[model samples]
Target: MNNIILSIIFFLMLSTIVFLIKSKKNISKLFLSILIFVGVLIGAGLLYLILMIFDNDTNISDTIKTMIPLIASMVAAASVVIATYNTVNGEKSSKNKTILEFIDITRDILEKGEITEKTTEILEQINSKLKSTDFKVDVLVNNGAREFFEFLNAVEGKEKIYILDRLEKCFYYEPGSPLDDLKKELIRKLKSNNIKDMRKLWVNINQLAGTPAKNYNILYEECSYSLTNQFIEKDLVNSKFYTDSLLKNDRKIVDGLLRKHFELKYEDIPIQYYEVYRVCNNILESNYEQIGHFFRTVHRTLKTINSYYERNSLEYREHIGMLRAQIPNQVALLMFYNAVYSEKGRGMARELLASNFFGDRDDFHFENNELLRSEHFLNNGRFLNNQDAHIAYELFTYNKESNKVYNELEKMEKKVVPVDDSETKLKEEIFTHYLFNKEKILLDKFIKEFHTVPRKFDEYKIFMNPKNNKK
Candidate 1:
């Protein structure tokens, strides 16, 4: 009886340790069944030993108790052992089935010889269903590739690409097969890219990426430029963000790409028409200096390409978020002032009128021009009330158009203010007094230049001439 009890205790301890070690592999509910079986076997063995030791008179019941305990323990251990095998095998079979399904789906894509929205969707669904399986598979395809051979070259073609695609398709039917191992082998084949393969690689990359206006070429160039920084080193003309498209009206896309390139590359991308081009909408309310810095850092490349330039002129005049664009109204204003300055340089006393204009004149309205009209009105109200010619001319050419603009300038301008009683102070006060009447001088010049005042200024002739016609 003592020997039987000792053997049962030893067997239970050994089985528990074995069960625990195997449990480490999966550690599922089979562990609880193993523990219960061992507990029942140990209890039965102890009970039989108690019956034997207490029944020393050798009764018929003592023999039955011992035999029943031995049979129960053997039965329990055998049942639990079989259940453990099923649990482990079930988990393995589920994993194997998942891996097989993934291999089959991947094979279908290769056999179809094309990728589509439907195909991508199918692949994603397979990824979802097979996530529980421990096998990791990542599919990498060159979106830009025209042929399988090109993709092969880009991935260095260490393993045969064409054959692998065919093999992947076949593995799906044999789910419990070596397909997982073969997929890993293909991944190994796709690791490195050579410098000579850059053009092909870039083309493949651009093909897969989507853009609203199909600016894939620009993206390809950007990727190339990022790899080499050749755009800066060679001083190449920065590529326009707009690619070849059907309608060809993508100015907004062009603007967005320009800003994105600048932000990403930190390279100077020439944004033409700086006065009108805005990098950020939020920057519109920013300080003039910050706006100026943004403009200066970006290269300005303006070209007169054709009638296309006509529609684009509107972008310059409006405030777009943080940035500002120059428009036709402002462009015409600058041109008029430049023409006036050029005339001044040429030493001409004759004030040029719209009728005398000879350069690029295409339906320019004197009143329609916003800058000219605003300046004319302001000066007429201020300095021209007193007919000061010099002041009117200076105001028209140099002064900013609005008081808000003037106040902004004053806040920016730094100068030593004059103290009272100094000689310089008196001169400043006198200049300040003259400056107040400066607008009158601008109105007088406008009257002389545009309103048909006499071109010849002779003191004796003017008195002889009609009073209204005096220069």
Candidate 2:
């Protein structure tokens, strides 16, 4: 009976030790130490039982045998308790040390207002340490939020962009639950009114379309010069009268004079095409760098949100909605034009599409049945209707068919007979037509026959099936 009991106890102890070893990664040193101490006592008891059952010495008294195991257990237990206490204290100290180091590095980086390769390495270390079960993320988040905002406030221009870019890369590669929580907290901080500059950073980027020109006066001067030159060339201008009218800066007077003297209606007035282009070109030249930075900032922000939440989840929708609201109708319209026309803006367009930035039609609308006034410059006389915009949105966002079409168009451009216009212009025209018509069958037929056929917009009708072809 004694042997059987000892054997059962031994079996349980062995099983427990195996469990503790298996769980060593998860459990703290303190608990593991306690288990080890208990294991040693169990091991001593097993040895005593073995002696009684197998040795059959009959030399030692029962009291001495019992006392031997008891004393050994007590001594071993005390040693283990002291060791475990020291281990627990040391672990606590180490964790504290790691956290302090992380804080110090973060503060140094923030103060320096630069993120280099070293910064990334330090961030990785911080991430690794924070991933430990012993670390409390809430404490770090609470303390770190203010520091992060301070960092944002300190950096500007290219430096800020660099930081955001590196931070995004970090988030992508060094993801953990704690880091996710930190990202959420950082997002919340960004949205909060506590950091006015941070809020302005996002707001200003979204509001880029509000002011496309560096100087409104410069645009006015260019327009005035173009209009005056046209009037003089038409033999309709009284030079002094035109000069006085322009000085007054009254559009009605200018329009009335042009109508009465030059017989030019508002719509008939020659678009200052070259002047407008110059002004726009200047705007792009001056602010293009800033615009790229702004796009990157918005992309990184949305990407971070996207990483943590499912696309269809309520949290995702709410956050995305809040971001979308910051971009006004004109701005969204500008983004559409950028996406369509500019090479550098394509990635921004993709990010915007992923975030459903154009999910609402009303958000892209402006007064006077126009998408936006800037449309005149960007549309190449092929304006975007709501349906066209919606079709483009669907093709880009839902089906990813637009990208395929773009690729096919590129291939067709290379193979087909050269047109008078640039390849870009031809592609833009056909792509715009695709958006306008939303004719999938025609597109498919065009793709199939493009290699042999001349690339002309007028020839697109031939791709239509006879049954559905319009005269």
Q: Indicate which candidate wins on lDDT.
A: 2
lDDT of model 2 at position 85: 54
Give me the displacement of residue 334 in model 2, in angstroms: 2.1
For candidate 1, lDDT tens digit of each residue in 384-420? 1122223223322222332232233333322424446
Model 1: lDDT equals 0.33
Candidate 2, residue 464: how far the Cα is off, in Å: 37
Error of 1 at 411 (Å): 56
**Which residue pairs come into collision in candidate 2?**
none
- Candidate 2 lands at a TM-score of 0.25
Clash totals, every prediction: 24, 0
In the order shown, the candidates' Cα RMSDs to the true structure are: 40.8, 28.3
Candidate 1 weakest lDDT stretch, 10 residues: 132-141
